[model samples]
Target: MPSMKQVTFRDLWQRFAELVHENKSVLNDLDAAIGDADHGSNMDRGLEKAVEALNASPEGSLRADAKLIGMTLMSTVGGASGALWGSGMLKFAAALPDAPEVTWADFVNALGAFVEALSKRGQAVAGDKTMMDVFLPAMVEIQAQLSDEESLPASMVRLADQAKAWSDGTRDLVAKRGRAAYLGERSAGHIDPGSLSSAFWFEALAGAVGQQ
Candidate 1:
């Protein structure tokens, strides 16, 4: 596959920010059921800041851009969200080559590092009714597709669909992490806002890659 340009990569985050803004209320409502009811607003604030930071800088290497976004999010966002996305993205930046463009495999490999950082920091797994519910399975599917020699665009498109289904599947899960954990049995029957936002990230990724 041709290399993924830095511009397109940056657009992925922009698309994600837009998606988050569009669904802000829906995400907050979902959180209202089980958590602080601020997931959407928190993420929106962080992503918007992240995008602004990106826009303020001249185009840079993938690592530099990712690091900028991560650091900006760390400082601007609040709560567990800031820690998770900020640190995870830092790891993602560290995993990538310091180049203006990279292959799809490089992006996916860096994504694995991002997810690993999230898993370790959050200590959550597939059934935890958290973002991992989407990240874990999406990582598995991506690896499988890579092994099967799927095209990058095709794989990302499938990932967007699979992520939504995985996020929706969270509705039946009892929360085992975060504030929702306190609700125990009552946590079931509501979608996890974090998981849905993770789905949106993949949707944004697919759209960005498609444009490339």
Candidate 2:
């Protein structure tokens, strides 16, 4: 069995905050290419509230903390991405409540749940060049890999790679949803800002797991 260590909600939130802060400029640059250029600011606000919620966790378990994070982001982020991302967090919070450690399978399921929630809420599909461009392939790869074997770190690394691929590949796809969708063919050749930001976020999560 692979060794595992528990991560506190507060610690995880701080790590996420650090990840966003470190990549905020990059996210902004990516957004400038194909979006309104506010993803970084929006995400930063949401994560700051998430950190606060983590700090205030005095009752309930990890699940509740996750739900709180979801709710905070939903309330603060205030965009199509925020609503979908927040829904994903809320769904996952319910899925893994009270677990001492997260397994590879659990993590994969959570990713699927996040994507599913987004799909339901946003009603988008593959090649939409939204964040779905990053998550859909990454989740599919994760589902395929984890079905054969179970290695948390390995799954995380693979997912991160898939995310990177999707991010890069989005440059070849035309935007078909959200604000970028308005740009039509012009959206092609420019990476979807949402996709790029999501790639960074997954990479950060992989880093967090690697640290453990």
Candidate 3:
């Protein structure tokens, strides 16, 4: 029932949760280097609960779905990732139309709100070796591609690659936020687990959009 022009909120989150599950070990390994080795486990647990909540909920409004995801992540996920994703998703839910589906423009606008919330809450920027490294650049690319009138599915493919590249770029940055920051220069050689998971988030979007 999905179209190329629009994506259902349910499909999006489900795909994201799937991607995280598939890459759980990789994420945990990445986190092991610079922080506590629980990023993968925590996110996987949280997203699984979020998906279960989505499946159980009767209402299908976009805002409701997003808010449910936010609250579920907040309650289930632990540490900074939980707080950032949970609170940011609340902002995302608030920015959305209370409908079953939304146009690509609406999705992008809501995503911008989510990114802004993350930026404000995490206080991390492009060079901080955090999730923002991927998110900030992805936002710029998404907006630019939107303005160019590119199809969502195609643009999402490119965005997924760009997200991974941005996440890769974090390897050399000294961590300025989160538990990794405690390691100082030692964090420089490792990728941020949050950024890797963020890449999976974009990859999931690409998969959902492509399937549509």
* TM-score per candidate: 0.96, 0.87, 0.94
- Estimate the overall C-alpha local distance difference test score of candidate 2: 0.75
Pull out the clashing pairs in model 1: none
For residues 3-23, could you state the per-residue lDDT of candidate 2 as single tens digits?
Answer: 223463345467767777777
Query: lDDT tens string, model 1, 1-212?
Result: 54668999899999999999999999999999999999999999999999988999998899999999899888887888889999999999999999999886788899999999999999998899999999999988876776332477777898999999999999999999988999999999999999999999999988998888
* Candidate 3 structure quality by residue, lDDT tens digits, 1-212: 12223235677789999999998999999999999899999999999999999999986678888899999999999799999999999999999888876767888889999999999999998899999999999999987777433466787898999999999999999999999999999999999999999999999888877777
Note each model's CA RMSD in angstroms.
Answer: 1.5, 2.6, 2.3
Scored against the true structure, residue 153 in model 2 reaches a CA lDDT of 60
Q: Total backbone clashes of model 1?
A: 0
lDDT for residue 193 in candidate 2, whole number 0-100? 72
What lDDT score is found at residue 112 in candidate 1? 99
The list of candidate 2 runs beyond 4 A from truth reads 1-12, 147-151
In candidate 3, list every pair of residues with a backbone clash.
none
Which 10-residue window of candidate 1 scores lowest in summed lDDT? 143-152
| Higher-ranked by lDDT: 1 or 3 | 1
Q: How many backbone clashes does every candidate have? A: 0, 0, 0
Mark the regions of model 3 whose C-alpha exceeds 4 Å error after superposition.
1-7, 147-150
